[model samples]
Target: MGALLVVILALVVGGCVCVVWADRGGPRWTRVVAAATVGSGRVLRRYQKSQRREVGGGADGDGD
Candidate 1:
């Protein structure tokens, strides 16, 4: 499990690098990878924001 997490982390970092490289007009494959990386990041951000709303959306009035 630990090894799997490490590998995933490495891939995310590499994808980020590819995003930067592709911004300056890199090769076709790097451009493809960068687009994928950006799309994945958007999905991940949406998931995280939804989780936060679920946790903190309580309507109870406690403060005075």
Candidate 2:
């Protein structure tokens, strides 16, 4: 009975963890605001890469 209880507890905890994790994809405007903000370096890099592909030069090539 105790072993069963332990298993149930573990399963409950695991489910809670999964729920929390599944809820953590960030806000709807996260990507849009990230491309604007320096908080998301990876998104910024991808945006810059796309911009470079669209244009002829790297993002840094333009004068700041």
lDDT of 2 at 54: 76
Backbone clash pairs for candidate 2 read none
Candidate 2 has a TM-score of 0.38
Q: What's the TM for model 1? A: 0.80
* lDDT scores of the candidates, listed in order: 0.88, 0.59
Q: Write the per-residue lDDT of candidate 2 for residues 1-64, one digit (tens) a residue.
A: 9999999788556545544444576455544443334434467677887887679654566554
Residue by residue across 1-64, what tens digits does model 1's lDDT show?
Answer: 9999999999999999999999999999999999999999999987877776688773335341
Candidate 2 lDDT: 0.59
lDDT, model 1, position 8: 99
